[model samples]
Target: MKGKGKKLRKREKAMESGSVEDVLRIDVQNLIVSLNQDNDGVAEGENAAPELETENLPEPGTEIDVKVVELSSTGDGLALHEGSKRVYVVPFSIPGDTVKVKIFRHVLDESYSIADFISVVTPSELRDDSRIGCKYFGKCSGCQFQMMDYSEQLKHKKRIVEKAFRHFSQLPPELIPAIQDTIGSPLQYGYRTKLTPHFDGPPSWRKNREPFTSRPPIGFMLKGTHQTLDIEDCPIGTDVVRLGMKNERARMEVEYGNYTRGATILLRESTRRIPKNESRPSSSPKARSKSPSPLPPDNAAVKVETESYTDVKTCVTSNTATSTEYVGPYVFYNPAGSFFQNNNSILPVFTDYVRQHILPPPSSPSSSPSSSQPIKYLVDAYSGSGLFTITLSSLFSGGSVGIDISDASIKYATENAAANDLPLSRVRFIAADAKDLFTPAIRRAYPGDQTAVVIDPPRKGCDQDFLSQLLRFAPRRVVYVSCNVHTQARDIGVLVRGLEGEGSKGTRYSIESIRGFDFFPQTGHVEGVAVLNRVDE
Candidate 1:
């Protein structure tokens, strides 16, 4: 066996260096000889009947070469062997290709095995072209499908959503229309409005054994890894955000002398206080002794603050101060430490879509009774910083309510409302759990007469109790904004089923429309909004 292995290796090396004619000559002769041997072996075995080919069977953990025959629901490649029971799922692989894979994780109960591809035996047509602009495309892990063409990405995302809706809810195909893709951002690169870059103590600080030695490096966390990737320049971040990171890095190096390790440094684009400073120990003796470094007269950091006509003020901290004031405008606010959509140009379009669906055009007088009231109330549940509530407030003369669990968000929402001159009585901001706020008593306090509820829950979807209360409240319309489609479908299924139940007899809410927003382009993530309207009894 060892001699045969060495001979094979030598032959492979010779083949690599030999001309095409030479390789063909060898193959012809080898095939002729192999045919003769095969004929002889078949003749001998004919009389005894063919023995089972046990000798060639693979061991339990041994990997085998296979051609991907299909794609899994999650877009993984699936491969199978004709006579074998084992099946493999190759990540980042497409169907209609051959790949050499090694099984890494296997469970007998599961139908498919997870594998890591060793090499491509046959490449698929779906293999993506190399990216043109960004060098950090793959390594950054910020965008997975950037290499794929934009059209193809949209098609795949639509298919993913459709499949999730079909498989999870078993909804009729006609009930779910093809996902509507929003216009892709014009500035595909360098379009991010915000960025949070973190840093640890400087190298010199590490050498000095200073008080702060465990600070994280200043930059985005490495893709999938806990280690920080020092980001001196990030193409996706806005200019001001990038500059802020650079300034923060310089300040940390100058003041801390590189002593910190494992500490997180924050560089923010908004005039909103960069969160990193708040993270520092407020009462630490060391903090008291350390004074913030002063900026040079010409090098002062800019700050961008905006106040809406309704009295909602947004303070964004950066290098040069930029402010905008308007009434009946949308203001997006993400958690101080969480990711949020940041495209300013498309903010109006996105909000307009939500508003239209939440409050459709008023019914003609001929279609309804003379006393029918126009939609008046709007409830922006999970309203972070009051973007949805304040922006949509203009549509209703009656008023709106914004509810959230974050106190910081409530403070910002109230200030934002006040800044916009939306009378305090017209819009009330509540800092309470959405579930607690959606109870029977609370719903009664804010009568459902001509009410519309806009719910933008986290990825996990709303809690069961909250859903139940929401169904009981039975707003005239519901605008569900979801970041994850699978959970969205599940929650929608629950709502649909609840509407069919006894207590919900007169509260049926049909899914009027659904649309997909490519907020995080180049990545598989997408945001969707669904409109549901109550059926009059």
Candidate 2:
């Protein structure tokens, strides 16, 4: 009995690892084991395990017509071939689409094959090709849903969130709340604040290493390949950045020979606030010259002015140069090359959602009735340059502290705090390892009952040690923001289970809500936010 319990626990842990392939593998193995157990009393010849039918598998380079019946979490279309009893993963094909695809590779062990999309014979009702904003939508790897309706895209994203939690959390369906519809970006196109375009130099194997007779592609990578497609303009980039791309490409025309290796050029959008009275017309060269960084000839500049202030937009080329952006009334300055949310239009909405959900845990009847302390302290882990710390400082009466492993990020957070005129007594920035973030000093300063933590980790999600430390800290509430929902689901599962055997005296957490924000609208990417509250049993 104990051995069976250990095996079940291992199975639960396997579910938490979070991948469609992993889940399928486990399911197949479990089925085989169950079949064997059922036939234990029967002769081996009576019910032998069926051999996998590999003879019917499709060959590479073969063309087949398939009707896409479902959309995978990765934004690809899934079609099952009846003849081969195999699933086909076709890119650039939407659910309900009748597509002609060329078989590229087979995953015979999994009974699925990968195919390259040829053409859509019949478009799905959800697809509106006319609505696709970019001409490079089909070839460019940057976007997956440009042909999909905006409303449909949001719906699909919500499904992605739901599927992530279902596949990875390993929790009962009753325990998880219904996921909310994905929040859409205000400006679908012309919203991305940064664009990186690159061009390759002559290959090393070439004997001559001669300069190219013609200019090479200076844009994003092509779909399924590392080679870049020459893109004169990208609709997703802000107008200023698009113009900057053209200007930089022209500059590279003359200087392309100066490099022996390929290089990526950074085009980050910077916004400056100028008093309306002092602002000049954006088209004027003088207005463009106001930038601290030297301007290229015919530099693009855009200005939007209100009664009190004018905001000018320009592209910053230097990675180390300071770039500025405005979220609401608040201002943020980070290194141009450093990581910042590329989608600016949706940040205000995203931050507001976080603010609204950070406090006042739901009342539980079973726990003895006692008035819960109002959450007065905020802890922003993986805080980058004070985006969340400063934006949320006003809500916490006791104080807010931002912690980051990067010392440079901490320095800028402090500077941003000062820049925003936030009272020093009300806010602080700490440079510390996230795993050791909740030290004795922090625990004493901000008690768990009155503190809320907001962790916005990278795409890889939080480390196990850091998550264990977080469980030990046990804040009243936790708002986890992640670019990758798969990782988020795995980490949340760990927190929900409370690190049972990980040498931590942590309690379980109840999930309050889960949702996705459409940070990158045309793409498969969705930013997931999961709110968890301590379960006071």
Candidate 3:
């Protein structure tokens, strides 16, 4: 019986470890069968449609017909059509333009399509003939609006933001501004503070994946394909960040026997200096030997397990040669196997916008020195690493509080507060769920003190409990920071309606302001900030 059970378990494990090709083959076969059933007894002339061709694939300049459906947040139309299975096209076409598009490359499952707008079948009055500025405009996916006029881009972004708010929040239109603008980037180029280069070769090409034989050559993955485009230059990253990646790639080729598969490389740069000995150990003894004496135990770099598609091995490279960092005051990050804002240049502007909108105006007489009132407090809910909380601590002299569900975030926020020289007594870090902590903690901390709540919720937005708690507390101001405007709107709807079964006293807050920031410029994602004030009446 035990032997039989072991055999069955082994069989199940084998089925679970199927390769990508195996899965694709099954899907293709099923699709082919479905097509055959859909068109039974078709004539040979009609059935002899060009065999799906993979050999001598179209070059970079080839054009094909594409149909677009959805417009990416960057205003690029995402094309979807039948017959051309697993294909998506982003053309210079507007929402309704159906024209010939050139296929850039066949990616893993879909084709990356771009258009040659020689003629518009159905032209809209909104379409303009403006030329883009950036030299690497067409190839680089960083800025989709490069070809679009600034004013048009703003209009498109505003429409997208407003639509999301209306569709998701269902709030009155008058409550929010159509759009909010921060000081635009003076010099768009060389603004990014961090850059990460990906390799498509063997293990030897990476510090952690060293000691392997020849594999595919190394480079960054092309925007639309699984194939890597050998990148010699990046227009956006700082010289030091770019140089560091270049040096690391060269060193990998020399140090390892050959580029091996399943290895990743990490390159990070920050304005905050990594003190001597805080750097990770180097793969090369020569590199390690040159560094200062061993780091103190307290300052040792913490070993955190990073999740990757494959087992990740890391090596550190520091460019001590660069005296001054990038041109702006920004936080640069290249997190391994995760999503992060790539445009580090505009981060300060984005952060400052949120801070200014959430914090009360300095000129308010209620907060002035002549008044003998206690300063109001702010709650930074879902505070990740305490970035917003620590930065805005100066607004509340009596201190403020931040709560997050993530244990790592709580620990980081605590350390960050101490690092920023904020009085620990004034700043309380609670490692608890935001929904559970807000109402009870506020009630316990101050029975009647008016507070302001700045919530930067996750993409899905707040839960029922969270909305309930916020409504219960009825903070003087609720600054909602959201990545998804739809959910933000839905949550706001619940908050605006207030508790059920209660007469007259229901609607607790009134929407005062709504605005959005284009944090992720090239993508369809948007970040919205909404301010709601408790209605005393």
Using lDDT as the measure, the top candidate is 2
Residue 492 of candidate 2: its Cα lDDT? Answer: 86
| Model 3 lDDT per residue over 262-303, tens place | 455555443323323435533222233455434324222222
**What is the lDDT, from 0 to 100, of the residue 65 in candidate 2?**
92
Better of 2 and 3 by lDDT: 2
TM-score of each: 0.67, 0.87, 0.62
Report the Cα RMSD per candidate: 16.5, 5.7, 14.2
All candidates in order of lDDT, best leading:
2, 1, 3
Top-scoring candidate (TM-score): 2
Instruction: Give stretches of model 1 more than 4 Å off.
Output: 1-104, 107-109, 113-128, 170-178, 196-233, 245-261, 271-340, 362-372, 439-442, 499-506
**RMSD, candidate 1, Å:** 16.5
| Clash count of each predicted structure | 55, 0, 10
Q: Which stretches of candidate 3 lie over 4 Å from their true place?
A: 1-74, 78-99, 102-143, 172-177, 181-183, 200-228, 255-260, 272-344, 359-375, 446-449, 499-508, 520-525
Per-residue lDDT of model 2, residues 125-149, tens digit only: 8888898888888888788888888
Candidate 1 local lDDT, 1-537, one digit each (tens): 445434533432332212222222222233333334565653342113222223334444567787776544343556765554345666445566677777665534433456665666776676554653456543454555555567766666665566445544335667666666644555556556666555545457557655554334566655435666665677666565566566666676666544444555433343222223353211122223355433223243444333411121222344233333221233333344444456554556677777677776565232234216677788899987787888888886778889999887787678767655677878889888866977665566566657889988887677666776677777777898887766676666556545334344334456776666766566666567888766554
